[model samples]
Target: MNSNHLLLEEPIRMASILEPSRPSYFPSMTKIVGTLGPKSRSVEVISRCLMAGMSVARFDFTWGDAEFHQETLENLKLAIKKTKKLCAVMLDTTGPELLVVNKSDQPIPLEADSFVVLTPDQEKEASSNLLPINFSGLAKAVKSGDTIFLGQYLFTGSETTSVWLEVSEVKGDDVVCLIKNSAVLAGTLYTLHVSQVHIDLPTLNDKDKEVISTWGVKNNVDFLSLSHTRSGQDIREAREYLSKLGDLSQTQIFAKIENVEGLVNFDEILQEADGIILARGNLGIDLPPEKVFLFQKAAVYKCNMAGKPAVVTRVVDSMTDNLRPTRAEATDVANAVLDGADAILLGAETMRGLYPVESISIVGKICGESEKVYNQDSYFKKTVKYVGEPMSHMESIASSAVFNFKIT
Candidate 1:
């Protein structure tokens, strides 16, 4: 007998197999989604992105007026026709964005353990930088020790990146907070995370409804990514609005889960959505940094088990400046693919950046390479675990058989 081999002629155990692979071939396996903005609005740039493996163009309704967004949509349609490439359009709504009125001319920069104020008035845009939030009854809702996550653009060019603030005082219409983390914040927006709150905020504001009515349903956009999706009801509300405006089934919803509340209701939320995005920018603030990766994996795995696409956003945020990504960013992209993300988004990385084209080009390469080894049968059997509930007993048996396959 050979020293390194244990010879066995007969098969001893059942080796499970993946279902028939009737895969549709593509230039790349995982899709690349780039935000259409100043850098990528033009036909030339959009065509370039398509050639570089972009499969979706996300129009963020956060900045610019309605006219600007409409123009972006028109330009996108033209670009799609010119390129003759199959691409989907994503209408990313500005859903329930809570912000503190910056009274100061400069953004309120914070240090660890610093004090900040949150007033309840939305109409009073105070210049004091005392941090007056737009959400009504926010002061009464937040108690001492509640986390108010300020989505700071602390990262070089990441839009929805955030830092934590712990509520230290909750007086009438005034909530004082101590900065729990040190962050040089540039943006004034925030997302609230508490064990509970009597929130009066509408899931989609008047502006969001107007946008969805005019652009989303009428334009027949493929994906509508509702930001800050807190529950299944939020998705149902959007669907209702879509139904009123046009054919309800024309658009697919991509729920953006960005907080602990959303995490708690993820299964229900996914039930309503056609797809989902684990938006890590604000999600990082919602959870401790250590836990965000686990949530991302869970969300992606669940989406996979349900046979729905899951996009992992904010993959290479710092690539806005440098052409090359940090080693960690590269690893992050690879992990997203191996963890079964169907797509990854470039928010500020493509929206307005120094190296948008290079960024897309680089990420395409990373995704292509990562997808090649994403879920080989041997690797899946060794490390994969389905957190999602199997639909039936047959599915459970199939899942078990998959993991029980022998190496030999």
Candidate 2:
């Protein structure tokens, strides 16, 4: 046989003798962000996650201390070396959020219609009748007849454990409330929210500034996901703070939309920040559950038109407990990809979940499959039309290229 014929025949013969090849797996264009917590903080788990297509590793400063995060960051570095894959590190700040402190270190049960005192005393221990909040201005921010929600209301699988308190009186730095429901406060740190009361707290709390200056700057974080981002001013303040703490120009800021204020000021926030994160868990709590999807769609469209990345979180929360995601959860993730999301963030799913690797793999597969039918042509046309007029030099070039490609 001739040399060309021999080369082709040898490959055909080898294929007949060799075992069947496994199906090829392609990575998704959309990024995957996995939260690192107690379950997925080890080097081995993180390596598997990177191989499974986790583009970003998120460290939530709300739960762990500086030392704990330091160790986890070290493990992440080792995992990156082993996998030879690039993964960006994100620091999620606590922002101006409030949490309840239970000094008992155990679950506290409150009876229905029982009287409870909500105090701003950090030194006070949480008792059956007394609950201490982290925010010092809690008493002044709330008035009589206002409703207070401690812990997540629903969808967390811990709704029964959440407590509802109605403010009966505000007396000298103490807000006396009546327990509306008999729920058990299971964790030491429970999120506290007052209904219809605007808590006048600074965008960046002291804890946020300290963490960003110390651990964030020292570690050279790649992204800062600002929590509860209300306005464009919040993004400006965070960028200014980073500028003062050495050269953090490489660190991109992602404003999180989690409340009504954030939704209202999204246009301005988008202009100031590098990206957007739709924190649906808290956003669901802030608005009616049915309205969260509407806001998400609008926000994602705006991000797409602006050519900025939009990340959707809490898409596969049901996977936190089970090995597979629910039908609704699967549809939610697919729809997010179809809606033009640049990334998907798994909070409790990868952080405290039983199957962290499985979660990442499943999400990556969903994103890849969804992209097949993403209707890119329609999306590009809509984006081009929305961005008409007053185009910058770069925008003009990009639009011209796309138009030429479409015609060709």
Candidate 3:
């Protein structure tokens, strides 16, 4: 027999299939983004995550300082070298978010039907009767009868430990509110949200700009995931800021769709942004829970049609504490892959979860399985139709590539 015939007759070895480094070769086209946190910040954990199919390491600038994140970055670099896998770094900005500052290390108990004073004074200490909000324009933004939610869980689901306060009066820089429910508030920083109130805050706060200019530029960040992106102007402003900082041509801006404003201006946002992140946690808070999935599906389809990457987060939140994911969570992952999501992002699942590596591996497996049933031909036809006739140069090239792929 000829050499080619002899090579084709050789059987693949099982030992090679079970190689330790085999997991590094991701089985699916859908990438995995793992957020770095206390649970997965160590070099060993991060290395395992990379081997389990983490394509990107996300650093949330909202919770950590520059020094803390720099140390985590160093650990990630070490992990990359150890695993010999290329992983991109993403900086998740805080954006125009409102937070509650607590002075006490313990939980402050607020009684039902009690009155509390909300102040914007950062210097003031938080007490059971006094709450300090980070937004300086809190008093101006809210009026009497405005409702404020203070906790992690807002409109997303049932209120667990969240405190409800209704604005009663505005006194100078302080706003007095009546507590509707009794709750114990803990943690140094708590997310604060006002119902139907539009706080006119800058898209990029001073801290966000400082971190991007300093740590982001220093680390050669690959992606900037802007939080609460409202419009295309936000993406442009971020790009301009990065340009002024240093040589960040490689840095891509990903607009996170988390609010009604973001949904309303999504077409323009998608046009300007390099990619889209469907942040369901905050989206659930902004819109009805039933509507959040609709937005996710629509946004993912739009990104696919635009030929841009779309990342879905909070897919398997229950896996944060459990060893295995629920059936619903598994279906969620599969559906996201079938929906043509380019990547699946793990927020609390990988950030503070007990099973970070397991989560990545499970997500990868689901993506690989889902890809088997993906109708590539149909998707391509839809994409071509979305682009229409007289396509641009890049679109024409992409269409040709897909056509060739189908025939081959």
Task: List TM-scores for all candidates, in order.
Answer: 0.80, 0.88, 0.87
What is the full ranking by TM-score, best candidate first? 2, 3, 1
Which stretches of candidate 2 lie above 4 Å from their native place?
Answer: 1-24, 152-157, 389-408
* Steric clash pairs (candidate 3): none
lDDT of 1 by residue, 260-375 (tens): 88899999999998899988877776578899999988888788777789999888878887789999999999889989898989988888877777888888777776665455
**CA lDDT, every prediction?**
0.74, 0.86, 0.85
Say which candidate scores most in TM-score.
2
What does candidate 3's lDDT look like per residue over 94-157, in tens digits?
9888888887767888999999998888788888899888888898988899878787552112
Best by lDDT: 2
| Model 2's TM-score against the true structure | 0.88
lDDT of 1 at 129: 35
| Steric clashes per prediction | 3, 0, 0
Model 3 residue runs over 4 Å out of place are: 1-26, 111-115, 153-159, 178-182, 390-408
Write the residue-wise lDDT of candidate 2 on 54-164 in tens digits: 989999988889999999999999999999999999999988788888877888888998999988897988888988888889888877888787874322435777887
Misplaced by over 4 Å in model 1 are 1-26, 103-105, 109-114, 122-129, 154-163, 180-199, 376-408
Candidate 1 global Cα RMSD:
7.0
Looking at model 1, the pairs that clash are 103-127, 103-128, 103-129
